[model samples]
Target: MLDVRASLGECPVWCSNDQSLYWVDISAPSLNRFDPATAINTAWKMPESIGSFTLRKAGGFVAALRSGFWLIDRDGRLERKLIDAPYDSTHHRFNDGRADAQGRFWAGSMNEKRDANTARLYRLDPNLKLSAMIDDIMISNGLAFSPDGRILYHADTPSRTVHAYDFDETAGTLSNRRIFIRFEAENDRPDGAAVDREGCYWSALYRGGKVVRISPGGTLVGEYELPAQCPTMCAFGGPDLRTLFVTSARQMRDPEELARLPQSGGIFAMRVETPGLPEPRFAG
Candidate 1:
């Protein structure tokens, strides 16, 4: 059985080199690191909301803030600003993001009120230049890349579909968009995802209390149920890459719902049969 604890955790990532699992508590403005071997957890607080983050090449992390991306140290130190993604017409904020195989950082934006198509997907290159990868999205959320780096998966919350794109590894471009999977009727919405070595995608359902395994062809293969309803994102970690770490949210639940699901905002864990790919590094 998987045992872990986190409140309002949003981005769950695995650091293979360190054999540690790192994630963020968005509403609480904190970052947590769990060492499975020591069975100990460490946390650091930040002054602002953090949408997502990833391991850096040298050390530390690249974090997404409400207005831009910044380099941060392990002690919650602000190294420097990298990119700015401010929306004028909407109260949109950065949500989920990850790095591609080439190290380019990609993330999506979403409206705080869940209204309008102001959210967008952005790509930041090593040169520190930012550009729109996709635009006019309702609520840009999770992201994933295929094993061969030929396919990219994205989700727009309102549409409730994870869309796939034909990706060009050399050019860093996307085309041929199509629906990858449609969530089951009662499964809230698809939030975040991670792709495995076999090209299967594991996605977290926002209000369903489950992490689903969907094949490359968009077929449902399995489901890992959780005690929380707002599972946000998931990533595989460990020496053998068999451990699955998940993040959850507590923003939208009511009192009655919270009473029944006290673990609603905590980070969760499980062991999966298949191992996952190393999280791609951000080129910038």
Candidate 2:
């Protein structure tokens, strides 16, 4: 229900306990929350770009900022620096990420140059330990997990493909990696995504102007087109978790594209027949 124009809108999260929706503006470098009941919007300026975050069980947020991962207070103030930037900030910065079911934070970096393969995916354990997972990635995006937590979904935007990995939920290990989807169009790429209770993967196809739902078997089942060409991400909200909230991006968009879709960076919502799985809270 939020129409706030973000330069680069991403990471729409539903905090059911608080009955609020949270999201981020990477180019604006801010964190925002909205209350549908009161139509109140709250924002906090971040020190650097924030790619993604997860709600904490202790009533705050654990986020992946360009500088590194940090614990943020409820009022959106920095509470603790969980860890320093693991990669060289001059060439790399955090792009997209989220938390796993085991309470471990997962974030990946992107090469600002766009052509370098000097990037990797990292995981922050509950104890605040950092470890690199996938390496040599370019423009990492679309981080998500399947409903049963048995599959981990990720994407390398430059390659225009989404990958599915056989996951070991208990150990947080990924194997048997396979191509979940590949775009034949050079401009169509996967961005952010979430899973539904039916075990279907809903992907926000950036520049494709639609959110596509694919069955667990990797079959395209449904597609919802949007006004914006760059829908960054989507998450389910509302009491029954049947409302799907989508965030789009206007940053770095061409002027002609922005003119056609005036509300390029605004947040939109739609009611869905199936309820989405609840986003998990970080135990640490």
Candidate 3:
């Protein structure tokens, strides 16, 4: 684990071009990068809560902040807003998101109060157009696409259910939404996730403190426990792409738990046999 930590660490992305790891601290509202070679850590403050982000094919990054999707330059500058947030920021904010293999940016909203079904999943096209993909979400997390781009997986954290949809890659449309896997316990709520080259899903079980590798057919294949009380997300990094890095949460956790797990907010890594697919760049 890296010595650095965050209150709410999530949305880990491996920039193979740079051979570094990029992630965000939702509570800290900052973007951070870690380079293993030099053991260096860097961060840039965000104006608002950043739920998630993706690298643009051309340059810089596209991020889903509380305000909306915006372009971020290398020097940590906001170039411009692609579009205003679809929902009211007073009660909601962007959460987990990523770019599909086709370069479509997909981000889902999170309901702050967890009372109403006001959340929705959004897709930003290459032309900068925005559209809704799904709705009635309590907490949107675990957004991932299959290796072939023919399947889409998402989850509602509070619902403890991870769902899969038949994806029309050509049109970027979804159909046949079905329960991919439903957690039977409250602590096993699914959070952020990523897919491997073998077309399998690996999800970070939030309070359950473990990452689960599920088959394409939604069968549990493997489970790896963590030292933290909450594992927020996981992504593949390193040159060989065999290292699985996981982010965790230290914010809002009990004091006793924090003391027991001093590395709660720190990033942890492990080696895996199956490699992960490269993070897709935003086409827009």
Clashing pairs in 2: none
lDDT, candidate 1, at 132 = 90
Backbone clash count for every predicted candidate, in the order shown = 4, 0, 0
Query: What are the Cα lDDT values of the candidates?
Result: 0.82, 0.89, 0.92
Clashing pairs in 3: none
Q: Model 2, 186-245: lDDT tens per residue?
A: 767888888899988888889999999989888999999998998999999999999999
Backbone clashes, candidate 1: 4
lDDT value for model 2: 0.89
lDDT of 3 by residue, 153-238 (tens): 99999999999999999999999999999989879989999998898899999999899999998899999999897999999888
Worst 10 residues of 1 by lDDT: 1-10
State the lDDT of candidate 1 residue by residue for 1-284, as single tens digits: 12343446777788877788888887778777878788777878877778888877767888887868898886668889886665752477788998888888887888877667878898877788888989879778769999999999999977788999999987889999999998756666989889888999998988888899999889999988888888999998888888888888777688898788777777677888889988877656
Better of 1 and 2 by lDDT: 2
